[model samples]
Structure formats: structure tokens, C-alpha cells
Target: MVAVVVELLALQVPENGYGSINDAKVLAFGEMGFGIFGSFLVLTLFFKPLVCQQPNTDESFVFEFLQKMGLNPPKDYGFSGSFCSWRGVFCDDKGENVVGLEASGLGLSGVIPDTTIGKLIKLETLDLSSNRITALPSDFWSLGSIKKLNLSHNQITGSLSSNIGNFGRLESLDLSFNNFSGSIPEAVSSLSSLQALNLSHNGFESAIPTGIAQCRSLVAVDLSENSLNGSLPNGFGAALSQLKFLSLAGNEILGRASDFTGMKSIIYLNISGNQFKGSVVEVFEGPLEVIDLSRNQFQGHIAQVNFSSTFKWSNLLYLDLCENELSGEFFTDLIHAQNLKHLNLAYNRFTKQRFLQVDMLTNLEYLNLSGTNLIGEIPSNVSSLVSLRTLDLSENHLSNRIPPVLAKNLKVLDLSCNNLTGDIPLMLIGELHGMESFNFSYNNLSFCASQFSRETLEAAFIGSVNSCPIAANPDFFKRRAPKHRGLEIALVLTISMVCLLVGLLFLAFRCRRETRMWVVKQNSFREEQTISGPFSFQTDSTTWVADVKQATSVPVVIFEKPLLNFTFADLLSATSHFDRGTLLAEGRFGPVYGGLLPGGIHVAVKVLVHGSTMTDQEAARELEYLGRIKHPNLVPLTGYCLAGEQRIAIYDYMENGNLQNLLYDLPLGVQTTEDWSNDTWEDENNGIQNEATLVSWVRGLVRRNQALLAIDPKIRGTGPDAQMIEALKIGYLCTAETPSKRPSMQQVVGLLKDLEQITL
Candidate 1:
């Protein structure tokens, strides 16, 4: 080897004298050893095409933008080619790219293919919500390392593009119920990492966009029902100071309810049916857990809204201001709403308020004041509403009695048209055990010494007075004298006067239990008669009277007759032993009793429960077309008792009960318009009392038509036939809202036979 390279250049001849081999330091040590082997062969051919241009360390780019939003990688997916083994892809751990995709409800439809989302330029998070995506391709906001965009309930329409604020790392934008209309974008208030914006029910109209107070990390804003009109944006409660759920319900927004007292970090505030008026007092401060200012036009006195501090509603739970015009003294600001659980102030005007200390709402479950103008009396401690399930003081103006502690755990009690008298109140038939529903129709209360059970007084009762003269009373031979006690007392008063003269020669076997009256001749039959009472049935001339003292407290005389052909075993034997002492009231449509029939008259029964085959065929076709119509403000049908499956109907029995126990039970200051005026019954019956003075005289004919001062004596009136009380106000307008507008019983017997020929 040339003498071993001449002894290795004489053992590298610079060993002893450092200056010799310095030819430019051996040409800089052979050009630094060929520049370290040509920089390791040009870094292995310049990183071998960047290690073959990366990618498969488990192919990611958010598994190609979740295979372009269609979310792939499932077949035997053990994906070591790691988008962390794909499947809703979420990478990171050297396998590079793709941060997260979420892929909710993934039945993903078309249109997200921008070369698998521009290879997810290191995407951070993109959740394709609900998915069936309609459009979104504008390079889909170039991702800009997106931070959370959920296109909710998609049908995604046009409008939203202010370059969608280029999603400057969007924090949470749901775009709710999508069909998005215009007027929201001001570049979505530069999203400063929007906290949670759900543009509800989209089609958003004017107002509301003060650029949404520039987001400022808003915490939840659901612009409800949209058509959003003006008022609300005065820095909308300090620009959403971390708001916690604010729903501007059914917007039309007419301001001034102090503009909702500065939102105070609202905890679910629903500006209900907005048209909001003044004096909503304290307008909320905080702690509210759900406040729906229903139907708004809010007038004063829900105790001037100062809800007894604790930030006004210390974690309140649902307080809906039903049909507002709110009046005062509702159980002292509704027992200060102690965490109330739904208390709808229905049709307000709350008069003479005395819910006799509503057991201070121990978490009341729902109490609606139906058609309110409330008068006192239901106070048997209202059975302390042990979480009452629903008790609507129907048509208020309450009365006395019928408060057998409200049938224990009443399920739905609606004391219809009240005035509530004696008789029918036998501790409401041994505490109605968890009653299901009950409504004492057009009351004056008299089921003639109640004692229910004939399958619970044929399911309860309806209308058509004195159950056919108490079933043509011979009084079952006076109850066979308690089954013949020593057969004496002059042979039981001569065998009950020879069984009441053989029950008046079978008075046609008691004319199927008499008392049926329907005398409408015509008066345009008063707006298709629905049912209040007084009698009518096209009367040219017809009089059937058997006065056993007017048939022992008659009332329960509804007779236009159709009640679904007829069944429930004919209302369990005409009320004979439906005698749980003949219960009396418990409402909503469940129990009301006092049936005597077999000729002793006095009937009032109503019972409705049995699960539901579509609400028992719509309450047996609305009580068989309201018992085959017949009017006089229509509350007739004085006959019906079926039994077996149970369904009883028989009305007529009102000695004044229900019109809410006579506006809450009379007594208090007792002036009720000078003790129920019509000139105090035209100075005690001289003018022969005419107008309908009950329900406290129609609340003094609607407080003398709003001139106020009608005070209360069961509405001191003796003048009603105003065309049969305006055709019984069309059964309160057929219970309003759906149910096909209600006037059917043959249009309520031709409008109560034209309101008895226009009240004759």
C-alpha cells in the first residue's frame, strides 16, 4: 500500500512541529471532511421528499376532514395509520395534523368536499351538527383553525355570511333551527370567541341586532320565536354580562317594563308574548330560575312586583303571568312565590281576593285562575295544596261549602261558574281519593242531600236539574223505613202513603225521572247555546210540571238529549246508592255528586277519569253533544246514568254554589252590591227577579261593564236574560283555542232557540 502510505505521511508530519501540514489546515481538514459527507448526502437527498411528504403515520387531516364530513374509517378500523385510529377523528401524538371533528348525528349529507377540507390545515375542532347540511362551502370559512361550529338542526339557508366573522377561532355558534334569514350579521359582532349563540327559530326580523352587543363572550342567547321587533338593546343588560339563558319569547317587544330591569345575569328569563307594558314593578333582579311574562300588557299589583326580596325570586321556578291585567291581593303576592312551581294568573282582574290564606304555596304544582275576577271562600285550608296538580278556579266569583278539604289530593279541580251551596258536599265523597278531574258546571249547588256511589253517582254529574224530580220521588218508600224497623209508626205512615199513591200511578213510571227542560223557541237561539242555564228548547208551548215542592230542590235539568246514543250502564242505576253520602265537588271533570233520582229529584253528577282512548272519545263527544242540546245559556241535560264503564249525566241542582262558591263565599262585608242587587231582588222579589243574579250576579254584570263598584253579593243581580246571558257567553267562547271552535250541540240548540225568541 505504498509502504503503508509512506508510514501514514510519516505519522502525520505535524505531530512535532504544528506548522507543516497546514495547507490551509489541510484545506480546512479536507473541506471539513467534505462538509461532513456533503451534509450527510444533502440530508439524505433533502429528507427524501420530506420523508415521502409525510401523511400516513396514520393518515390524518382530521381523517381527511372526517372523510370530508361523511365520517369514514370504519371497516375493521384498527387504524394504526392514526387519526388516533380514526372514527370521529382526533389526532396529535406525532402522527401530525387533525385536531378534532366530533361528527354529530352523522347521517351526513353532501357538500363539504374542499379536497377533504383543504387537508385540515391543522384543524382544531369542527362539529358538523345534526347534519344534512344544505350549504356551507365558501372554503367553509377557510377553517382558520376553527374552534367549534355546530350547524344545528340544519336546513341552513343563505344569510350568515359576513365571512361568518372568519370564525376567528369561533367558540360556539349553533345557528339554531336553521332557515336563517337576514339582519343578524354585523360580522356576528366580531365573535371575540363567542361563548354560545343560538339564533333560535331563524328567520330573524328587525331589531335585536345591536351587533348582539359584540358577543363579548356571551353565555347563551336564544332569540325565541323570532319576528323580533324593537326595544331591548340598551346595551342589553350591560352587553350580556356573561348572560345565562335569555329567551326573548314571541317577540313584538313594545318596551317599558323598565326594559326588564337590567337583566341581572338572567337565569332563564323568557320575555313572554311581548307587548310588555308598564309597572311590572321590580322587573326582576336575579335568582330567577324561569320567569315567563305571559301575554304581557302587564298592569299593576302582583303586589307591585316587588316579590319580597331574596333578589326577588330566590331561585324561583316558573312563574307565568297568564293573560295579564293583574290586580291585587292574590294571597299576599302569591305567598311570596316561595319557589313557586307554575302559578298562571289566568284572565286577571282578581277581585275581593281571599284565597283564604292559600296554605302558603308549599311548592304549588299549578294553580290557574281561570277567567279571574275571583271572589272569596275556598278556604278549608285548601287542603294545603300538597303539591296540587292543577286547580283552576273556573270562572271565579266563588261561594261557600263544597270545601271538604278539596277532595284530598285533588288532581284537577275546576269549580265551574261557582256559588257553591249546601247539600252536595259530603266531605266530597270521603275525600275523593286522588281525584282525577271534576268541574261543577254552572253552580248553585244542590244535588238534594247527596250520598254518591251508584258507580260514584254515575261518574259524577252534568246538568239537567233535580235528576228528574229526584227520580220521581216516592222516596223509595222512604227507604223502606230502613228495611222495616218494627213495621209500625202507623205502618210506616201507611206504607209511605200507599207508596205515594202507587208513585202517582207510575207517573208514566216517573216519566223517565222527569225534570228535563229545554224551552228555546228562538232569539237567534243566542249564539248557538252552549250551557249556563235557566231553560230553553224552542218553546212555542210546552209545560211539564210535577211540583213536589218544585221537585225537592230542583236544578239538574239539561234536556236537549244526545249524549252518544247512551251507555256507561245508564249512569249506574239513576243515583240510588251512589251514596258516599253523595259527594259533591272536585273538578277538572272528575267528580261532583248529589244524586237522588227515583223521584226525589236533586241531581248533579259528573265524573271523568278512565285512562284515555283519546280522552275517552273526546269526553264522549263532549258529553254526547252536550246532552242533545237545548238552551237558555244551555246547562241542561237532566238525565243520564250509564254505570258499567261508567258515564253519568244529570244536571239541575243549583241553590247557588259554583261561580266559584259565590265569589269566594260571600260574608266578608256582605254588601255584594247591596246583598246582590237588581234592587236587592227588586226589593225582595216584588219585581220578580229576572236578570241572572248568581256567580254573584255575573260579577255585577261585569262590574257594571267596568264602571267598577259591583262589590259582590253573588253579583247582586236579578236581571240576566240579556238574550239568555248573551247565549251563555258562548260557553266561554267554546273553551277558546282549538277544539274546532266549539258551538255544536246542533249549534247549541239553534242558539238556545234564538235566545227564547230574543228573550220573548
Candidate 2:
């Protein structure tokens, strides 16, 4: 029977097929092969379980994807069993397909390769955020099943593609803190299911797409810190009824506070740092928990609004209306906002009033009413708010002694620039060590320095009278004794004049070396230096500098007028020894004082604050740069004096006063007398024009391709016309309606550098 089967197999094969078999077994090979195949087929059918296992398509695709991404799969993802067991990998109930990947903050880099991640057709949630990914693969947009996509905090660039519309099921999309530019694609509105969309901290420009109003399902939308402009789209607030948290801050969106009336569910609304103006009452119509309308032009009083009908005041946890044009009495109804933790109403033109009736807001932790024209005594009722941690009542006309019963939990206290008088409370003095910031400067308050450390005294009282009784201040007798002792003062004055003449003669030759050496030492010192007193030979006048920091043995180094030699003694006498009466302004860096030198030269001395991290070399370099540069509009850096840790820069005093006074000191709609008397204030040569008009003029010229016409005639032929036009275009960009739309100073420099022959 075998021989018969072999003859049949041989007959089925080609004639040449037998040559490839062993020559010795050529005749019987067909019979043996037929028997072996039949036996093996029968065995495999019965024992299939003994065969080796291989992964399914989903597992193989996941392995390949991870391999291509150069990612090390979690430890549990061994070369056996299912990938569903791996960390950050989610699978369906069947464990057959990948459904989600929470691979955020992984060391993922470069482009997401094509056909790798997209191959996971069942993927729903993918979080690749906080990576170094620069671009997406071509097939990435094909992940139609994705419900949540988070690629935030990455290096992703370029416009978000219209192809993103393919994510029909996406519920949350976070691409914030990326370099994505260009207008937000209108196709983003196609994601009908998207509930949370965050595209903040990007370079996105142009008005927000009107189609975004269609995303009625959006619950939270944060488009802050982008170049978005124009008005809110029609039906934006009304259509997105489900929206609760919306932060369009740091943009230039123009609209009234009333525009948000339809967002009935808005619990957290922050439209700060925008160009939004007009009355602010309607913004409280929603049951809001947090409301930040700061840095806008919102005006009008809140007294007329019925807080009871507007919303649940108890639900309001945070409220910031700072830097607006709002006026009238403080919101007495705010007492009803018992849950409010923070309240900032600073820098507004409110009418003079008594201390805030905030004793009811016991939960208030932060309160700032600075620069609000507040008057009367700070009510002791404030002490009832035991949770209050920070309180700023500076730049107001408040009078009388600080309440002894201020909140014990208060960590920050600023009562500067007030008429507060009387002795400092022992309670506050005892709590000095625990306070983070305590300023009572420019006040009539007196405090005993016996218990307080020199650091505490200097830090707390810069411009205080400090006229404690002899029992409180041991030096009180010594300071007052100078007035009665005429002969002692005369001898001191004589010696000071002689020493001043000698020091003047000495500094005239080596002033440069002395200035540089003193500056270096001032910058190098790590410890705080306080100006305890002036030179022994100098006058006894107590100036603002006396309370500042310890004095150093260095002369005032005049940069522009090197020959105008003056010792540190001269600076003391020039500004009445840094008297608080001569105090001009409390600047961000420090304080500025107006003084007159011996040569009838009026100068403004700015004192750089202590505890700066800036290196000595950097400080020196900055000073040198400022001294070398001269601009017609800028105050010339006349000189500088280093007194230990304190760095003082002197500039030619402007009789016209600082910018704050020029802009805000007068009443609204009132022009400066100079504006009427001097037509030169409006002269185009001085680059003075209505800011809006100038922007419009330049924009028109640029739009018509005649930007060169707006350029200064002197610099017209200096640089290439193309470069000039490009530079003008950048200037136009800087004057954008919103700060977010404006290029950063760094970006502007980079753009200018890209242009040939363009000078900044």
C-alpha cells in the first residue's frame, strides 16, 4: 500500500522535482514525505496547545509604537502576556485593545512618528503633556476615537491644524504653555463634545474665532496670555450655558462687563488685564465663587447694586477689582460675603471714607485698600477677622494710631504714607519677629527702639519721627541735646567744613577709582548695611538716608560732571540729610528724593533697596550702561554714590514731576496747565500725539505699503527700506490693542535682528 501511495505522489510531482531530493532516496522519498505529512497533520490537530504563542495585532502595535518612540515601557510590560498590565496603559474590559495612555511627563521627544500611536485605533485618552515634542506625525490627526488629548507644556510650534476637527469625540484638549502661534483654527468648534479647552500661554494671535461660541458643551475655557483681540463673539455667553470657569485674562478682548450676563453658571470669571471697560455691576449676576476684574477700565460704584438679588454672596471666595476707575464708597455689602478669602480694591479713585466695615468677613485672609483715598482711623473691628494674613492700607489719608488689636495672624502690614500718630502698640512690637513685612514709614508714629533689633527698626521705620521719650530711646537725649549745645555744634560745623574741603581736594583727582572701588565693595557685601549716622563732622540734620543703611566712606561719583567733586557729606546736606519731607516717590526699586546740590543743581536721588540677588559686576555694568546712554526724554544718569549696601543713583531733577503725578494727580477730564500754556506739549516733533491717533496713522500707512512715510526723515536712508518697513511693522505690532498681542521685548529684539541694517 505504501509503494502504491509513493507511486501516486511521484506521479503528481514534476519530473525534475525528484532531483532536489537525496539521490539515494529519490524513489522512496515521495512515500516517506507522504507518510510524515499525514502523521504530523493528525498529531497537530490533536495537540495544538503545545505550539508557541504570539501577540495579537493590538499588543504588537503597542510594542512597536513604544519601540519607535524610544520609550522604555513600564517594568510590568515584560516580553510576555498582555500590554494591558503595563502602567499608564488602560485597556477595555476585554483587555484586547489599548484605550488610554497617561504617558505625561515622560521623556518623550521629537516628532510622534506616523502610523505608530495612530495605529491604536481604539485609543480614547492620550496625555503626552510636559514633553519635548516639537511636532506631530502626519497620521496623528487620524486618532478619531480620542476623547481627551493633553499635549500641554510641550515645545509644539506652528498653527494648530484644521485637521484637529477630526477629533469628533474629544472632551478635553489642553495645549497650554506651548509656542503654538497663528489664529486658533475655527475648526476647533467642530469638537462638539469638548468640555475643557485650555490654550493659554501661547503666541496665538487675532480675534478668537466666532465659531468657538458653538462649543456649547465647553465647561471650562482658559484662553489667557494669548494675542487674542476684538470683541467677544455674538452668543458667546448665552450659548455656552454649561461654561463655568472662563479666564480670558492677559488678552485685549474688548467688551462691557454686561456681555457676560448670559453665563448663568459662571462660578469663576477672570477677564483681567484686558481692554474691557464700562460699568461692572452686571458681572456679579452669576453665582460666582471667584471674580477678578482688575487692570481694566471698569468704572462706577457698587453701592447701587442690590447684592442680595445679584447672587449668593456667601459663595464668593475671591474678589479683585484693583487698578480700575471705580469710585464712591467701599462696598458695605461685602460684609455679607462671609466666605471671601481675598479682597483687593487698590489704586482706584474712591471717595475719602472711614475704614472698611469688614468685621463680618472673618474668613478674609488678604485685604488691600492702598491708594484708595481712605481716611479716618483703622477700625479696631478689623482685628476680629482672625484669618486676615495680609493688609495693605498705604498711600491713603488715614489718620490716628494703628489699632492695638490688629489680627494676630497678620503676616504682612503696610501703613506707610499715612497721618497715623501716637506710640506703636506693644502687641505689634512683640509680633515684629513673626511679621513678614511691616512698614510704618512716613508716619508720625513713635516707637521705643530699646526692645527692637537694629534690623527690625530700620526695616519697619524708614521715615518715622521716632521721637520716643528718653526712657524709650536712650539716644533721645543725645539727639535733642544738640539743639541746646551751641558751642558743641559750632565746633562740629567748623571741623566739618575743614574736613569737607580736605575730602573735596582729595576726591577731585581719584574720584573714578574711588567710585568704582566703592561700588564693587557695595555690590560684593553679602550682609545688609544700614546708615546709622552721618560723618561726625557733618550737620546734625536727620535725612531719609539716616534711617536707610549705614554710611560708607565714599564720595558721590558724578558721571556727566566729573569735575563737580562732592563728598558723601555734600549729598547729606543736599537733601537735608535724606529727610522724609523731601521724599518724592516710593518706587518699585526703592525711594526717590529731590535735593539741591551746592552748585544750585537740583537732582533726584533713587535709593536701590537692599537684599537684591543681583551680582556686583551686573550692578556695575548696569550703572555704566545707564551713565553712557543719553536720551532727550530720559533723565540723565548724573552721578551715583554707594553707601555700604545701599546704591544711590542721581539724575537731573525734572521740575515737571514724575509720570504718576503727570497722569493721575489731576481730576478726570482736566488737562495740565502746561497743556494749555504750551502748544509744544502736543507737538509732533516731540513725538507727542494721541496714542490711538498715532497708532491708527502708522497702521494706515503700513496697510497702504507706505510705512516709510511714517519714519523719521533722518533715518530714512540710513537703513534698507525693506528693513525699515519691517521695523515699522514691528512697532505697529507693539502698539497692539492688547498687551498679549504685543511681541515681548525679547521677541521684538529678535525680529529686529532678523532685519538687515536695522538699528534699535
Best by TM-score: 2
Clashes (backbone N, CA, C under 3 Å), per candidate, total: 147, 9
Off by over 4 Å in 2: 1-56, 64-81, 306-310, 449-456, 465-760
> Each model's TM-score?
0.25, 0.60
Question: Candidate 1: minimum summed lDDT over ten consecutive residues — where?
Answer: 539-548
lDDT of 2 by residue, 406-488 (tens): 88988999997788999889788788778888888767888765777765666468556555567676564555565668988
Clashes of 2: 9
TM-score of 1: 0.25
Report lDDT (Cα) of residue 620, candidate 2.
Answer: 45
Question: Which TM-score value belongs to model 2?
Answer: 0.60
Candidate 2, residue 406: CA error in Å?
0.4
Task: Give Cα-based local distance difference scores for all models.
Answer: 0.58, 0.74
